[model samples]
Target: MAERDTTGAEGAGTEAPPDRKRMRSAARLGAVQALYQMEMTGATLKGAEVEFESRWLGAEIEGEQYHAADVKFFRRLLRAAVDRQAEIDQLTDAALVERWPLGRIDPTLRALFRAAGAELLALPTPPKVAINEFVEVAKAFFDAGKEARFVNGVLDHVARAAKPAAFPA
Candidate 1:
């Protein structure tokens, strides 16, 4: 894993923006992009992992200094999502209408869905929160109404079918 540049200067005397939520959303968006690149290029898992770190660093430097905890949390979330991808894809496919294979979906959307669904099913976070976060990410990069709604609906189905135990009470 690439080390975060902890030596970087902190924003002196400046209160952090209230945009941490958006930044976190953007990080997950970045992870989806990395996953899409990996799938399209047929890169190995290690290659994809390295690419994620590199891209994340670039994003951080271009953006602001994200809290280390948030950065670390996203990295863990992305890895867990990648690790359980096959199972997550299987579950997602099963939930789809007419057995839509992941490859048949738009690659970007597929990656986003897989990443989101993997977190929903495998991570210890609440399902509704995961779905909402990913929906926000999708909205940032795509048409919010139709595409975002599609993502939300499919992921909701996956959450119910794949890992009902993780669903919100």
Candidate 2:
């Protein structure tokens, strides 16, 4: 989600309040990116978290501006993904078909799953909302609809397992 900087040249315009939904969506995107950075670069949780917060969040990169993220929500998602990593990975593995395990998946997809799994396990977000949000994330990274559909199916299974009460018999 790209939100342009709204301030005028002299910073005289009245900037609108941040949209809560967009901020949270940006947070999800940031968390996934941070996790992917950690996985690829061997960055520590604190290091990755700080780097994303300071350098990436709301920063224009490659000429595209990013939306301001919900910092607290971003931190929570990143921490949950790192802290409960083994558990999240286990849940993801269980959700995937036998031929494709968690480790064998694309790194970006893996990161997205970890962030989404953490939210499913630790946050109060409704499972469907989490699923939809992450499906959108998958769409952001993948050009084809196939990857988005794959993310949707896997996250759906993970959500059902993580929050059974949300999906009653």
| Worst window of 10 by summed lDDT in candidate 2 | 7-16
- What is the TM-score of each predicted model, taking all chains together? 0.72, 0.89
Model 1 pairs whose backbones collide: none
lDDT score for residue 108 of model 2? 99
lDDT of 2 by residue, 25-123 (tens): 899999999999999999999999899999999999999999999898899899999999999999999999899988799999999999999989988
**True-structure lDDT of candidate 1:** 0.69
RMSD of 2: 8.8
lDDT of 1 by residue, 1-46 (tens): 9965431112223332455545555557766877888888988667
Off by over 4 Å in 2: 1-18
Runs with alpha carbons beyond 4 Å of true place in candidate 1: 1-20, 56-69, 166-169
Cand. 1 TM to true fold? 0.72
Residue pairs in clash, model 2 = none
